[model samples]
Structure formats: C-alpha cells, structure tokens
Target: FYSELLHIIGLVETKVGGKRLIERNSEGQRHSGTILEDTIIHLDSLDKISRLSKAFIYGETHEERLFNVALGLNITWINRILFLKLLEAQLITYHKGDKSYAFLNLNRIREYDDLNRLFFQVLAVKHEIRNDDVKKLFEKVPYLNSSLFEPTEIEHQTLFISNLKDEKTIPALSNTVLKDEQGKKRTGSLSTLAYLFEFLNAYDFSSEGSEAIQEENKTLINASVLGLIFEKINGYKDGSFFTPGMITMYMCRETLRKTVVQKFNDLKGWSCVEFDELYNKIEDKKEANEIVNSIKICDPAVGSGHFLVSALNELIAIKSDLKILQDKDGKLLKFYDVEVENDEMIVTDEEGHLFEYNPK
Candidate 1:
C-alpha cells in the first residue's frame, strides 16, 4: 500500500517533475469533458528544468535530487498521518467510541487545505492561543506538541501537501488495495487525497482491548507495524536492506538480556551470570526498579527504531520476570504476565486475557 502511495507522491510532488502542464481552453480554465487525444511529451526548452534545480535547498546538484527531497517529505507526512490515525482511534476508544476525535475521516478533511489547517493551526499551535475560528472548529482536538506537526525546513522553500491541486488525479496502481462496489480491486484514476484516506479506512485500526484473532476482524496494527511500514518505505527508493523482525527480535533478546544482567551485577556486588538470577536476589521492588531504570541502551543508526522498540519490549519483559515491573508508584503488577512476542509487548492477566488500559 505504501509503495503505491510513494509512486503517487512522486508523481504529484517534487519540483523536478510532476503534473507539470495541462491544456487550457479559451475560457482560461483547464480543458475538460473533451474527446481523448494522444498527448506527446515535450522539453523544447530547459528553462523550467533549470529553475527547478536552482531551488534545491540541499545543494546545487542534479535536478533528480528533488525526487529524494519529495520522498523524504512524503515519508515524514506518512508517519505523521499514521500516528494521528492511531491517536484518533485511541481517543475514540478511550471515550467509548466518540466520533468527535475522528479527524482522519473524509468529512473533516476533504482537501489538502483542511489537512494543512490541522497540521499547523490545530495541532502545532498551543490550545489557549489558537485562533478563534480554529478553536471553534477543532475544539475537541487537543494540541499535539510534536515537531512532526510543524512544517519542515524544505516546506518553507518548496511545495507541500497544501500546494497540491485538489482536482488533480493520479492513475491508480494496478495492484491497489482499494476495492470496487462489487468488492473487486479498483482501477483507473482517483484523487490522491481520497485514495490515501480510503486505503487507510479499508482496514480496521482497532485500539480496542481485544487482541484475539477474530476471522471477522481486519488486520491489527500497533506501533510495531508502523516501524515495519517505515522500514519497507525506506526500501522503496534505493532497495535499502530491511532488517527482518526475526533479526530484530533475536538481536534485542541476545543484547538486552545480557546488558540487564551486566548492569545489575555492576550496581550490586552479586556475581550473577544470568538476568533471571536477580529475581531471587531482588527484595525491594522500588530499589530493583531503580537499578533497572538506570540501565541505558542506544542504537546509533535507528532508522525506524525497530531495534529500539524490540529492546524496550525486552526490558519490560525482563523487568516483569524480575518482579521489578512497577507502576509510577512502584507497585508491582504481580498478577499480570508481561512478555514480548512477535516484537509486540503483550500483557495478560492470570486467566490469560489481554490486558486493557483504562486511563484513571
């Protein structure tokens, strides 16, 4: 799905190339409702191309660099939007399926301008100081103090999502996830904005408590799924190597478990070879949690932080095994079993039901 979207992003965006020009009628409007005609590509003049290359903020290099910039920006927007989808679903679930926080729907965001307002006015700005009109429209929307919501340095110089034409439509991918009314895969062209949102809504993005595999349920995706998606998109441009989930799981398990043991051994004089040994030695849950929390882990080239997420899961599972996994008040969740499976942190009660978090 993202691979197809990347193609469309490149087609519409990028200063070097895109929907460059279209035939205009005598009325000074775009030519439409006309018979089909063969259109030939022309580059009789290099003036437009030269101007585009000159605007490259990274460096005065080949015009092809614009593709890279476009790819980067597209990835940035994709991550931000996907995160918002998760946030939106989580809010609705927390509020017992209230539709007010559902901002990703078609009604709330019909065009790029609406999305632009959401990015800058609604989310980036603080709640109190937001414009009166924006506040009234997005009253239920909380201010998200994230740099992701802010415009990038490249955006200041070049085109953004808002700059894209609402009327513009791109040829749908042959292998599109979109389905027709008859439930067959859709073809032909579609507005990129609608395509994106429709593709997103095709699957169920559940933030519900039940992780049980139901045949009726759509694919379940959490943060780990986003990590994989980001990694896959990274491969879209240069055929970059994607570290597999098996590799990440193994790497985190092998590295973090030993690191935890070493940290505890270093802090205390206990000569334990394995992390599990600390379980018996641990007495005060507070002190053990303190010791565990002191351990730091870092990944120098964390592209999508897949490794980091796996490592975090390992830490949590290790803490739980050591009986040191505590709430903010340092109280142990003794009845809960926390473990990492398939790179996801799963919490189950004594009866093995998925644990649901309800905000207090």
Candidate 2:
C-alpha cells in the first residue's frame, strides 16, 4: 500500500512539473497519471510522497518513515540551540549533571518564560544587535520586550515566531563533560550552541522554498510532524508515535459524529441515528447554534495536537454546514474564530464566547 502510494505521488509531481523524476512500479513498470493544471494538493498527499520515498529507497517501515520525515522538518533543534544560548547568556541555569534547565525560576528573565518568545527575541537580535549589544539585551532580561527587536513586517514576524513556538520542551543534551581512558575531555555534539545555531541558520524555515510543497496546498508543513521528528532525533524515551493526519481525521469525524447525534437527539427529544436526520429534526436556529457551541472536544494525550486540530477543523466544517439551515437573521452568524493557546485550539463564536478544547 505504501509503495503504490509513493509511485502515484511521483507521478503526480512529474505531472505538475515539480520534478523530472519518473514513477515506476515494483515490477519495474513505468506508471503515469493525470492531474489537472493549477490543482492544489494537500500536505497529506506530499507526506505520502516522503513516506514512500523513504520506504522504497531505504527499506524503512511505516514507523521509520514517519520518524525520518518528522526529524527532517522538526524545529526542536532550534529549541536546543535557544536553551543553550540562554544558558550561555546566563539567563537560566541548571544543577551540575542535570540534563534539564528549569525556566520556572529564572531570576534574570522577567518577561514571560515562554521559550517561543525567547527564540523570537534571538531572531530579532541576530542581525541588528551583536557583540556588546547582546550584553545590553540580556542585562535587562526580564524587562526585555521582543517587540523592540522586530526585524521585518509584523505579519511575517508573527508567522515565523508562531511556527517556532509550536512545540514545548524539546530534548537537549546536557552540557556535562566526559573523560576518555586518557583523561581527555569529551562533550556532546550539541554542546556548542554557536555551531548549532550556525548550522540551523543555514536552513531557511521561513523561505518559500523550504515550505513550497505544503504551500502548494495552501498550507504549511505540519508542526506535529516536526515535533515528532525532533522527538526521534533527540531519542525521546517515551514510546509515543506520531498519528497520521488521515487517521486523526477519521477518528475525529467518527467520534464527533456520534457525540453530535447523541447530544442533538437528547436535546430535541428525537431518536435519530443519522447526522443528517438530526440536523433536519432541529428546526430552531438558536437551538442548533447552542448545540454547536456547546460541543467541547478533548484529546487527553495530545502530542503535537494533530487530533485536536483535526477535530477543530471538522467542527468548523460541521458548523458551516449547519449554517445553511439558518434564517435570514441567522445568516449574520459570525464566522468561527480560532486561536492557539498553549498548543491547543481555542475556538469562539462571534459573540466572543469561548469553547473549551482541552488537549492535555
């Protein structure tokens, strides 16, 4: 199944003139397909391309393919660099031999202890402030406003910073030293923060080229995929696996469909088994609005929040469909507003009422 999908993706790419690569079957037969010009494909389709390429060329299993794809695009490497940079700047500290640096008690840092915010500050100062200028920036750590160091347009800066801030608590190597048999000191590859930053800066995460495949679908590379990649790279001890978007979507849809049916049927005193039947039974727009708004979704073990995101998108879609039943006044129903707080999706109605979307 994986290999067949890979052949199709290669064919799709070639059809769109994305690459000169030719698609072939396992039996060494060339394969071809047609895709309409200017048609936008989703990121999931491209992910299949990455997965199949790894599996066919490297003999990687589905799990291995997912890990490799995640590692290639993960931004957690940046977090490690930022953490070490903060330590070098004396803005934070850890006990000797402690692999983790605790930000909860950093006295010098007065601003929000958000690692994402700190990274933005670093990017902002990377070019404009240097040498002795950095000393001044760190000297007033707690009072340092990242906004003061904005380097580009507000929209661009916001997108880049938000992307970086998607995941929390990336695995990083401890700065502790080791000695060989000859008593020579040895350190982890990531111990040197400067070298790591230099390497990371070479890859332009914000460039159109970096995200071209995803942008073709009017989306960006999944942050959850990147987070999983970082976990694999850092050798995360937990046995957690990255759930594919397709699986997440299916699970969310089925779960939400059942829940919505039950809730609506119970509310309207109707015994309907189908979602469409439930929708048709509920003639009151206000009642429908209440039912939609009251629905809360949670993913208890949310990692990278793929499930929650899928649920949110599904809910928004369901709400839009329900809007068709709205009267002329109900047509003024404001579009759903969504925000990401602490990596969870927070959706609200036009009246500014917040719906809970807890993913812990």
Candidate 3:
C-alpha cells in the first residue's frame, strides 16, 4: 500500500507544478497502474510538500523527507479508511446485517471522488445539510461526528482522496489472501480500489460477540485487533511494535489490580490483596466505581495506543471480577461475565453465550 501511495503523492504533486519522470527502464510497463517507481519525484523540493516536510518530518535529506511524508500520508489515509470499514460493519450489524448503509464498497464509492465526498462532505457534515448529490448516493450513511471524518492538517496542505486517479491497478502483495479462480492464490495485480474494498469485505469486523459463525470461517477483526495492527504498522519506521497484547493484558491486570487493592486498603482498614476479597467487603457500587475511576493509566510507548486500550479492558474485567460492573441504571451485569482472554475482552452469559451489543 505504501508503495502505491508514493506514486499517488507524486501524481498529486504533478497538479501543482511538480514534475514526474516515468522511469525509462522501469519494471512496470507503461500501463494504467499505480506504483512507486513509475513516478519518481523530488517531493521534498516541491513547495507544498516542502512545507509539510518542514512541518512534520524530522529527516535531514530531501529523499528522507519525501519518503516519510508519503508514508505518513498513506498511513493516515489507511487509518481513516479502516475506521470507516469498522463503522460500516457496525451500521450493518445494527440494521440486522443490512447492506444498504454500506458505503465503503465500490458500488457505493465507485471512484476516489465518492470516497472524498464520503470523507469531507457526507460523514463529516450533518445529514440534513449534506449535498443532495452525495446524500442520495449514499443512503443511510449517517453523519458520524468523528475527527476521522474531518480533514487533517496534512490534507489541508495537500490533495484530497478525490485527486488520485481511480482506474489504476497496483501489484498485489506476494503473501496475499486474495486467490485466483483456479482455486489457488492470486499472483497477478489487482485494481487498487477494488482490491482494498474486497480485502476488507472478506473479513468479519463483527463487534457483536454473540454472532454465530457458519461454514465459511471468517477472521474477526475488532477495534482492539485493528489498534494493535495500526500501531505495529505505524511504528515500522521506529523498529517498534505493540508490546504483545497478552503481555499488555497481564501487565494491566497486575498493575491495576494491585493499585485498586492499595487504594482500598489505604482508605479503609480492609487488607484485601485479591480482587475477589474486595467484592465481599465493598458495600456501595458507586463508591467502588469512583475509586476505580480515580486510577489513571498511561502507556509511555504511545505507539498505536494498544496499551491504553488493554488497560481499559483490564479495568472493565476487574470491575466484572468484583461483580461491580454495572449498566446506566446502576444494575449490575450479573447475567454476563466480562473476561480478558488472549488479550481480547469477551462478554459471555452464565450459559456461555457471547454478549452481543444490539442497541436496536
């Protein structure tokens, strides 16, 4: 993805007086495809990119700065896209698996312009005030009041998604889940946008823990897993990735469990060491909740924020262990048990059914 995006940035630069030299001896035959080597550019030398390079990148040379800028832009775009992918999954889950609200597919967003509008005009704006052109085009895609939908500082100084040509194809990754019709792995290239949407579509982004799986086993990609992935990918330049989720979960449980115990012991004369001990001693759920709320956590690494998410899950699981996890009504979730297993939070009933969040 980063490889293709390097060429995209260069292509975008060409609109604003940036020069591009199609490599004469390039591996890619002069086809209608997007790839990095196809369009070689001095992006850092360009005025627009230079401003961004100066503002964000700490690299010394033009080549260094150019690569960093392209990478940052590509990652930012991918994150936003992934967020929407999850959002689409959520909306579909809410509507009884209805596909009407799904906007990430090529059918709804046929080109980059549609995606651009989805970002800046449709999701970014309130539904009532959106342009009729896109509002009708994307039915039931509600206005998600999220910063992801808003244009970033980088986008303000550069081209939007609509600026990139959509008819381009890019080489598929060698290690790919995409397969060919001969019941084998696909080795050839694929249309850029088509591949992205289809790749995401193949996975099940089901937040609902209660959903049953059928014959076709699908990979479940949730927010926490996505967070781990994004953090790992973003930290590739730094040679750092997420402290494995198991370790994170264990660390959080140990730290938070001890901290909670200490706070209770200090405040009261209760010499509780285990979370289970506190369950019997605590009288008021509100007081216990306030105590838990007082605890603050910070992951100094701050890579993809997976650590913080782990801490959050740990807190919830701790509360569940103490039998104090409650709903908006102050009624305990006695019917369910929330546990952190394999670094993933699972909510199940006494009968071992996963708790599905169906607000509908």
Which has the greatest TM-score?
Answer: 3
**Candidate 2 minimal-lDDT segment of 10 residues:** 31-40
lDDT of 3 at 180: 74
Comparing 1 with 2 on TM-score, the higher-scoring candidate is: 1
TM-scores for all candidates?
Answer: 0.81, 0.38, 0.82
For model 2, residues 11-37, the per-residue Cα lDDT tens digits are 211222332322222323321220110
List the pairs of residues colliding in candidate 2: 70-229, 71-229, 110-142
Off by over 4 Å in 3: 1-47, 50-58, 207-211
The backbone clash count of each candidate, in order, is 0, 3, 0
Per-residue lDDT for 184 in model 2? 54
Note the Cα lDDT for every prediction shown. 0.66, 0.41, 0.69
TM accuracy, model 2: 0.38
- Can you rank all candidates by lDDT, best first? 3, 1, 2
lDDT of 1 by residue, 227-335 (tens): 7677666544444445776788888888888887887788887899976787898888788788878878888877777788778888899888887788877677889
Runs in model 2 deviating more than 4 A are 1-220, 230-235, 324-360
Candidate 2 vs candidate 3: which has greater lDDT? 3
Pitting candidate 1 against candidate 3, the one with the higher lDDT is 3
